[model samples]
Every structure is written in C-alpha cells, then in structure tokens.
Target: MERREFLAALPAAAVGLSLTETAKAQTEAEPFPGFQPPGVDRWERSDVEAGDRPVGASFGTRSEVFGRSGAAGTSHPLATLAGIDILRKGGSAVDAAIAINACLGFLEPTACGIGGDGYAMLWDPKAAKVVGISGSGRSPRSLTLEAVRSRLRNGFIPPYGALPVSVPGTVDMWWTLHGKYGKLKWAELFEPAIAYAEGGVPVPAVVAYYIRRGMTNFARPGMGIEELDNARATFAPGGETPGVGEIFRNPDLARTYRMIAEGGRDAFYEGDIARAIDAYFKRIGGWLSYADLAAHQSKWTQPYSTDYRGVRVHAIGENTQGLATLQMLNILEHFDLKGAGFQSPLSIHLQAEAKRLAYEDRARYYADPDLVDVPADWLVSKAYAAQRAKLIRPDRINDKIRPGDAPSRGDTTYFSVADRDGMMVSMIQSNFRGMGSGLVADGLGFMFQDRGQLFTTVDGHPNIYAPGKRPFQTIIPGFATKGDQPWLSFGVMGGDMQPQGQAQIIINRTDYGLDAQAAGDSPRWHHEGSSQAMGEDDPTLGPRGLLRLETGVPDRTAAALAAMGWKIGESDGGFGRYQCVERRMDGNERVYGASSEMRADGLALAY
Candidate 1:
C-alpha cells in the first residue's frame, strides 16, 4: 500500500504506556506487513529510533579568568567547547561566533553553511547597548516574477528556482560583525574552523538525522551526487557523506575560510568565491551575478522590543517575524498563564488562543518594510492584542484563524553566547531548507540558501517577490533585558514554528519561572495548523487537530481539553533544544543550557 493509506490505518490515540506497548509489539511481531511510511514520517534514524533515550554524547570546557571567555549554544558540545577555547585564547563574541558557525557548517551542513544567511543580536557590555545585524540576502536581480511565472507555466519549477535562490550574506555578515566588535584577530578566529574543515569533524546525531530526512530534497537535478561530490572533494575522499559519528571534513571550505581571513570581505565579494558563484548561476540559467554578490552587505538596525511583565523582550526588527513574538507575548500578558499549572488544559488552551491570534497578524502584516509597509506599532500595540484576545472563545481553538491584512515579513540553528565581560550575543543562521537550495557550488563546499522562495508568488502580497528586497524570514534570535539590564540571551530553531517557540520560551522564563533548559525541555504545543507529516508520524492526529501536545502531558489535561472542544493530538516532542545565558542585576551570570532527552540523539551540556 502507499504511505498515505498506511498512515491512515494507524491508531489515533494519545501517547500512553498502552500505545507504546502496541507500537513496540507491532515492530516486533511484524504487524502492518505491507505498510510503508513516507520518508518525512520516518523521523527515526538508527540512533533515534526510540524517544526518551539518551542522545549523542555531551562534552564542554570553560574558564572564568576574565581576560576573555565565551559560552555558545550549538548542537554539538565540541563545537560549543571550541568557541569557549577561542574565548579563553582572548577571542571576542564575534570571534567565537565565527568559529562556532564554521564548525556547525562542518558537522551540521544540512542545517546551515557559509552559503546561507545569518542574523545577529550583539551586546557590547561596555557600550551598554545592542547592535542588530541583518544577514538575510536579497533575491537575484534578474529573476523577475514574470520570468519565474513563465518557467512555472512550462511545468518547470527550476531546481534552486528563481523564486528560492538569493545572494549569500552569511560570510559578509560574519566579517561585518567581527570588524566592528571583535578583540581577537580575524585570522585567529579562522583556526578552529579551518582545522575542522580541513582535518574533519565528527558528525553529530541530529545532524545525521537532517541529512537522511533531507536526502530526497537534496536529490534535485543540479543538486545531485555530482554537486555534493564536487563540493566535498577536499573533505571526503570519494565525496561520501558521513554517517553518525563519522569524520567529515571540508578542506575546500577551509581554503574558502582562509580567503576571508586573509582579505576580509573582499576575498568573497570580489574574488574567487564571487567568480565561482557567478559561474554556477550561469550554468544553471539562474539570474545571480557577480555584481549582486559584490553589492550584498549586512545591515545594522535597531532591534524591536516590548515590555512583557517586567522583562524587556527584544526581537529582530521590521522585515522579520521577530515582532510577532512580541505580539504573542503581548497577548499572553493579559492572561494569568501560570495559575493554570504547567500542563493544564486551561493553560494550553489560553496559550494556543494567543498563538493562533498572533500568527494571524503575522500572516497579514510582517514583511520587508523597505518594500512593503508593516504597521509595526499597531500590530504590537496593547489595544490590538486585547482586541485579538476578544476573538478567542477561551475553551476552543479558533481553527478559522485568518492571516490579518497588515503589511509585511528553516532547518535553522540557533546558539547564544555570553562572555565574562558581560557581552551577550543571541545569534541564528540558516540555509532555509535542509542544506538549503541543495545546490553546492563546485569548490565552495557549501549549499546556497532558498530564502527567495519565502516570498509569495501572489501579486500585491505583503511578502511578494521584488528585486533587492529581502523575502519574509523566520530565523530570529532573541535578546532580552530587564529595566536596561541584560537578562537573557536565547533562541529556538524550527521553521515557521520559531516565533511560537520563542513565545513559549519567554512565557516559560517570565511567567512560569522556568530556567532556559527547563523552558526548552518542557512540553510544547505548536499551533501551526495540522502538519500532514506530523499526522502520519503518530496515529493520534485526527483531521481537525490544531494542537500537538507531548506524551509527557497529564491525561487529565488531554481529556479536559478534548471536552473543551480542542482537536488535541499527542507527540514525542522531538529534539526541542535551547541554550540560554542569563545574568542577574548583581552582575553575576548563570550560564544554563538544556536539550530534550526525548530526542533519541540530543545532548545538553555546560561548563
């Protein structure tokens, strides 16, 4: 039978001991003999076949001597530890970020890379202010909407199509941030990354999971074995993608790193990398040019923020869905969330209502303010939040949640850093989809981002395609302050679910009084409509399901919520990891990080 029919035949019950036993028995007894699951539905790899198990190994190191020290939020403990090493060697936050980012490129290439884009929230403790860097890239100038539409009419959605390809700005943004705020020499920051890229870095469990799931997505015409092989020439002998715990290297990427280390942004924008990118674009009939690559630059903007209770919440400004997080917080501010307890139905219902409302506003108004006007002030206003709240029925989810008409705005990775000197950085970067457009340039050792696909094809849409204008984005890193004091540095990574997860993190920290890891590891209810893939993963997801709660939640809450008219579904709450560095008003810092144990392949460590 086909995968869909097989999934439809699976059980539809909440996660319980009974369900687990049944699933296990089915596996052992060879039940559903003809059934085959979709590739996306098979989230389990050899390592993470079962939930609630210890994930990959955890390791970290740190020093508090005060000349310089940095803490990172990254998937692999070794990568985070490497950043700390850079800090111990007198590297700044920017320096550590560059190091950790390059290491992630090596281990988690399916998540992000040198060919992607990044956005950063930098805090200069001495300056007592923050700098926002927009690392998002613009669409190729030559790929007009009309041209793309014509291609679509020809029954061709071009591989790394005109709609998805964008000028890469990650390297540019890295150099820009380092040039402004780094204490260590740029060449020194490149050491760990170059070593990892050239020598090899072991693949982590989660990174391996992404590769397997994204394999089919990576098999497009221009992004097949030939491309991955050419890109991995310097790293893998015959260009073989490494399995979990296997050593994978990218000497080509190391050379690319050295180019930037030696000549700053010029090495990438006007040199060999530029020529390589242009040549690839020309070969693919894409519109990106040397001029676009040379002209692309990172932007410095003020972070938009709102007061949630006593804590000041900051998110990326106008063009991003960062403000939507503030909107969610604003709506939740009017409710007594904690009074309902952690997993109570009342608590879940109230939060889901707030999420549905905020996302509606996000769909209507959030976009690039330079190209389309986003009413930021109105959307984030207390009155508007109150008005939106009135639409919630309290006991039931408003599934008819519509995207409000306003103005505007990823396998993504996020990691937060805090130094001994009070400098805190909340950074996020991604290639959009897993390994992004999946088109690795010949010798660049990286995949391009599919950011342009984020733009809507519809005319007059707030996020519609436009030249030199950024597409609506979801990679938001969060920075928060309490009455001018740096309170926390945090972020969560999961495509469209990012802002919702951010709001969940904030509420857990602020209202629920949970620390960073506790907040991240706690049960989460994502209200991003019912995902067909999610429904197939578990038997419990019915057609009307709007809320996907974790198995850890109390049965009383599920029954109560069902009676309250919620189409609730159960899940294992996979790899919901978050890293946070919190500081008190007394200047003492508590660096805390936690990842989901439910992730059969997750690890959270601190030093």
Candidate 2:
C-alpha cells in the first residue's frame, strides 16, 4: 500500500495522537518489516516520545512583565519556558541560561546550535561581580593565511562549505559555567531539551520561514542534495521543510544530548563524537583535527565596563564586538538623545556617525586577545570617545571617518535570564551567518560555525587569519549595573546589528526613561558598511553607504537623513530581535522586569 493510502486507512483517533506518539505506535506495530522512521536513532528509543503541543500562536507583541520570583526572556517562547522551569526547580540563573540555550540549539537551528560558539556575562550575587565567559574556539592549527588565500576567489572566503568551519566552543562554555555557578547537576539541565527533542516540537513560525529559505538555497542548481545530506535529513526530512504547526523531531540530536549528559564534555570533545567529527572533516577536506577539539578550553575573564549616565555597561572583552557597543554609547553620552526626540534626524545621524566611527576601529583592532594586543581599556575610555565624538557633525553626516589611534575592540541568537536572588545571565551564541557554514558533522545533527570567515587576509592586520587564532566575532552579550548591583541583562541577535542594538536599547532606557519592553519595541536604524571615497569604489563596501530604517521611523526622519547625504532605505523587520531582564527597586523591595522583541516569535515570562 502507498504511504498516503496507509495514512488514510488509519483510525481518526490514531491520527489525532501527537506526532511523537503516532511515530512510536507505528514503530511498535511494525506494520512493515525492516521499516525505520525518518531521523530515528537506531541504538535506542527516546524515553519521552510524546507530549502536549505548544500552546498559542505568537502575537508578535509581548508586554513588559514584573515578577517577584524570577523572569526569563528569549527569542523563543518554549526556550523561555524551559528557563523558568529550571528556576522553579531551584536552579541558579546560570543553570537556567544553560537549559534555555540548549533548547534553542534544537528549536532555532538557523541562529545557533551545539556546533557554534557562545559568550556569556553572569552576575554572581555571592561574589558581587559580573564574570565573563569566552566560549569562542580557535582556528585549526593547519589553517593559515597562505592556505586560505590560495583558495579564496576575491580575498574573501565563501560563506558556506567546509572551508569556513571553525572548532565549536559552546559545549565547553556550557560545562565551564555550569561547574562554577550552576545549582543543579549538569545532567539535569539537559532534561528539558532532551524531552523536547524526542517528543517532537511544533515548528515555530520564524523557524519555519528560515528553514524554507535554507531549503530553497540548497535546492538551487549546483548545490546538490548530497552536499548537505545531514542537514536535509534533520531539517527537511521527506524532502520538504516542516510548516509552522507541523511537528518536527531530531532523535539524533536527542541522543547526542544524552551522551553529553552522561559523559560530560568529553563525550563531545574527545569521545566518539569528536572522532566522528574528525573523520567527517577529513572526508570534506577541512582542516579541523581531534587535537584541536581536545585542546579547546573556555576561559573565565573579567568583564570590561564603561560608565554611561551612572549605569555601568559590562561586555565580554577581546575577540568580540562588545567593546564597540560601549564606545558607541560613550560617544552618544556627549549628546542629549532624549531632548533630540526619538527617531529625530539629529538623533539618528549622531547614532549612525558614532557607529561608523566605532566600526572603523572595530574592523582594524578587534581580534583574539591571545594572538594580539587588544587595547580594550583605552577603547572604552571616555576620553577616547570624546575624541571620536568630535568627528560627528550636527549639521551633516561625516563620511571621511577612519580608525582612531586608541585601537579597539565582534549573529546570532540571544537570551537573558534572571533569578529571584538577583543573579542575572546575559548570553549570546551563533554560527556567524544564517545556518552557519552549512557543514553538518556526519550523523551528528549540527552545523559547524563559519566564524573563521571574519578574519582578514591582510598581513599584519589585528584580525589577520592565523593558526590557532580565533576570528573576530559579531555576537555579544550586554549587561548593565547600577551602584554595584545587577540592573539589566540583555542581548540583540543579528550580525553587525548586535552592538548597534545594544547602544539603542541603553539610550532608549536611560535617556528616554522607557521600560525594558518599550525600549526593545521602539523603531530603530542600522548603518551598513562605510561610504565610498569620491569616485573610488571600496572593495569592502561596494559603491555607497546604505542606511536601513524600520517603518516606525517617520518619513521625515528618513528624508532628513537622506538630505544629509545618506542613502536611506526602508527595512521591514527593524534592526534585530532583543531580549532583556531588568532588576529594579520597587520602593524597598527589588523586582524583576522582562521584555521580548516585537519582531520575533517569542514572549517574556515571569513567575
């Protein structure tokens, strides 16, 4: 009998079973001998094979919430719920964040996964200080500038394929954070994600959209199905992407998580998983090795901060663009953004000019700290910002700005978590570009990050490609403190939009007195690349500068920016998705405030 005929013949009640139960029942029945379900693990059946479907359609508008116990916010409602569940189980904020991020790896694969890198900022209430975790992986020892240039077409590595793959650092970071601040057993944190992976989650609307987009790209001519077999097998089984309400499962990922839970980090870094990854890289002509995986370690670094209007802004130092956000905020501190009015021409221009100056320095100086001297303290110094602020003209845009002498400074999904005890966690993770390098380890069910592509091929450049050197990263986690107490934990997920979003959120909250939710919901603008010099076309920026403003920005604001020589374009989706949790004093008691982005299919939940 045909598959459709078999399905049609089933009883309505059988059909009504949640997708997970239906699959298990069919497998148990063994209707056809030797038949195996798509994406099922051969070794063992998942323990939790069925559960209730996710509730409600995303309304795209979430209210700012206040909670006395705890608050959690993320780019996905399910992930947020998972974090809250952890907190309810008497886990710390770090434990909740780890659980939340693990779920995101399974649910939002387009933005992040176990194969990517991560950075986090955690406020330890006992220690009374914010600690930074750098989970970024280094380049393969065999991958060198000469080797990369020999394969490059125009001094730029292709965005996809094995060439751009980097060693994954997320798993290491997870274990490191958990070992220090986690209140629950490491295995316990993986339970929620494992259950979701096995029970089959309903595809979220945003995830379905990105999955379809990826399928379309992979189906194009010359991009054979065999090249991304693992991806197709996991995300597009049956040669079709799942729709928003359809159930999707990855038993392989569930198994992988279980192994890591049992064997700790060694299962992923030095055991069968690592060996399989090494073999896969060899087959694909990639440079990663088992030694690199075994040698990879996560670092606990002191977070760097800058004072902006009495609020101390903390960001991960080195190899990340977090410092750039601080610099931008410093420059904007010299101006009265609130008095200029939200989205006003003067405000927009000043923000854009500051970003341009910050990015110029970022492109020049930000890189792996272990490999180069990153002048982090000098970059975030108020005096240096004052010097860069002088380059911004109130009357017109300045296109001649260059990297300052002070030196610098780095896409991705972000989620923020805060527990009732006032401990906060701000975390960001990514694969550098959408869907990452598109290289899934054979049967591992995850994509390797394309972060290495960000390294410059130029000799002597701060971000120059080198063996065992980490590339400059775009994903950053933002944290803010007031009077040495945890005040805010937030992050924005998008390539260069991260720092830009960070600066805007701070300005909106501090200068305009907007609540966390309102601050994230406000319309925003992004300045893409630098302007061309006269008739010369910048190889990096093409011909002209492009300014993208969301629809919320008034037409007059765009016109005013355009009149000042910026090529303005309207953007449908605003700058990026933002998630934030702020701790505020409600009289004598401290309360938590949480906010989720309006442009995303997520919610801010409190309990």
RMSD of each: 8.5, 13.1
- Model 1 residue 526 lDDT score: 69
Q: Residue-wise lDDT of candidate 1 within 1-607, one digit each (tens)?
A: 6966755665544233375775875566554444435534344332222233243211111111112234566766766777778777777767888888877777677767877889989777788986689988888787787776664522323335334778888888988888888889888877888887788766766676667556545554554232444534533356455666787777678888888888888888899889988997787666778988989988898888889999888888757778878888888888888887777888888877777677666655667887777888878888888777777676766656555554343467777766667788888888876667656677777778877766655556677667777877878888888878677777777666678788887888777776555676666776544322110122244324466676556678888888887776556343244556665442454433323222323333334
Candidate 1 global lDDT: 0.69
What is the C-alpha local distance difference test score of each model?
0.69, 0.83
lDDT of 2 by residue, 1-607 (tens): 6978878876655677888888777777664344556544232322322233343212224457889889999988999999999999999999999999999989888789988999999888989999899999988988877888887745676567777678899999999999888899999999999999899989877888887876677667754223687878988989898888899998888889999999999999999899999999888788988998999999888989999999999988769888889999999999988889877999989898898888777887788889789888888899999999998899887867888875334347899999978789999998777787777887888778888878777777878788888888888999999999989999988888888999998998898777788788778898777531211113565323678997667789889988988888658453888999999898988888899987777888988
**Going through the candidates in order, what is the number of backbone clashes in each?**
7, 4
* TM-scores for every predicted model: 0.82, 0.87
Say which candidate scores most in TM-score. 2
TM-score of 2: 0.87
In model 1, the runs with Cα more than 4 Å from the true position are 1-70, 152-163, 220-240, 403-410, 530-545, 569-576, 585-607
Candidate 2, superposed: residue stretches over 4 Å from native: 1-62, 221-226, 407-410, 531-544, 572-574
